[model samples]
Target: MKQTRKPPLAVVQISRAVTVIRFHVCLLFVFFASTILATLPSNVLFTSTAGSAVRMPINIIANQSFGYFTKPPQSDQIGLYVRDGDGRISDAMITPQSKYQNFLGVSRRQRTQGPEYAMIARLVGSWTDCNRGAESCVEDGFRLSAFEIKTPSPMPTICGDALITSETPTKWAYRDLVDYQYIVVAMAHVKVDCDSGVFAPDIQTRADGGE
Candidate 1:
């Protein structure tokens, strides 16, 4: 019987090297693919209808009692600087206009007088990185496509339910005028000019009012 010949050691070694090279090439392809995806823009258009459920809860209230107000109907964007109970601040944007004008109206009233209000709302949008040289984009923040306020009804009783007067019987505390848990603030239509690293709005007002 003829003896069977084994493959040469050099050939076997070459085969192993080729397998290792193939594995590394596959790894490199995946790494580059993921990097490219990470850099792609993720701006989502706001399309939430009225009464829609809140999807992503930001769990925050406006840091400033005043200054942030609801945008007018003609404006296309709403800018906010919101903070959680712990006081962690973040930049938020409400875009494409306010679909829930009723809520915005309520907020406008409460905000104009100067009262910090909490919100229970859904933030439907993408959280993108700050622009290259944006001064106000202090931290990576949310570019809200939709904001839906969901303040619980039959307001909490911790605060006096009746509108309490501070200065006079006819004068009511601005904070007591509305349900703090469900009021709106900083819902204005403002352009986010991160390219210039400025927070300049086309219009400015002393009295204020989002989701």
Candidate 2:
């Protein structure tokens, strides 16, 4: 009987390379598949509640709009206020306070105040706890400069029109110049769905410490 011939070195090497390539292709496919799942209803973003209550004063940055890495921070980032007895949080678009009405395109259409947030928030973010000033100051249970403050009622945390699920990440997320807490992902002005209406704020005093 004739002996079987062995495969050449080049053939073996080529086969190994093909195996490696296939492995990489499968890995990429898995990653993209997971990202697609994140976009679906399954993966929610900013779903967890923050529990740090550190007071930090913040200053509003520029009125101009700047892009983050590849995407933009949420301009006029409508925050989710504190949770209520019902375990709900309210999410509303920033009221279009038209100090720069012309910039906002349409005039003040929100209500008594301008828009809840600016069309584009560059570096400027005021404290939510301000009494009467361009800036506001707010104190809460969360100590971090920034926390996902839940609304008093249940509302959607949206990016553009679609809701942000837990899987959604801070892509090209921008932070306030003075404080890291005021971070946002800017999405140009778009129609918003305020579930109910803005909830009454929880009365809380500012922490005496924290510069």
Candidate 3:
């Protein structure tokens, strides 16, 4: 076979120019794509699980004290905080519109509308409005995010059993979970703004998840 000859210098130059053009085109495309992404509405919904158990066994005292303080929560269960929340609220209707001016989130100066921190309770079932403006007559809600032990297999405990076991940590905790519910045993400082909120994950709340 005859030996192959190299392309002419002009041909090589043209080839190099074509390659440079293609590279620039690609770079421009990436730049445009990134710019578009930045312009689009960004959703910052945060979700996470600590992969721990909630095992605070309550004695059968019918909500009666065991005459002794419950043991301090385990290391994994304590000092939980919601991450990434500035904990600011604005232009929201807070109940107890009374001395409510003194509420944490309410601005004493502004009185009604101010940077407020709200306590949002999650109810078990569909919540309905109560008559006579009764705030206490609403559906059963939780102050703390009730959590049960996370298990690989279905762990069943007696519904009638007043004693909380490692399997079922709460008196009635068999309901499906929802957003912002802390599944671990730790205490989390939930962070949010007036618009929306999420639990800042990977951080616990000794310092309100760094507030």
TM-score of each: 0.21, 0.22, 0.21
Model 3 bad stretches (over 4 Å): 43-211
Those runs of model 2 whose alpha carbons end farther than 4 Å from true positions after fitting are 42-211
Which of 1 and 3 is the better model by lDDT?
1
Q: Tell me each candidate's RMSD, in Å, in order.
A: 22.9, 21.2, 23.6
- The candidate 3 region of ten consecutive residues with least summed lDDT is 159-168
Top lDDT: which candidate number? 2
The better candidate by lDDT, 2 or 3, is 2
Residue pairs with colliding backbones in model 3 are: 77-186, 79-205, 80-188, 80-205, 81-189, 81-205, 82-200, 83-200, 105-116, 105-117
Q: Write the per-residue lDDT of candidate 3 for residues 118-156, one digit (tens) a residue.
A: 112121112222221111211111122332211111211
lDDT digits (tens) for residues 1-211 of candidate 2: 9999999999999999999999999998876564433333322452213211210111122111122322533333344233334534343334445446435646534442212232212212333332211112212212223312222323333322211111122334433324334433321112233454555223223233323
**Which residue pairs in model 1 clash with each other?**
69-209, 70-187, 71-187, 71-188, 71-189, 185-209, 186-209, 187-209
Q: What is the lDDT of every predicted structure here? A: 0.32, 0.33, 0.28
Least accurate stretch of 10 residues (summed lDDT) in model 1?
157-166
Clash number for model 2? Answer: 45
Clashes of each: 8, 45, 10
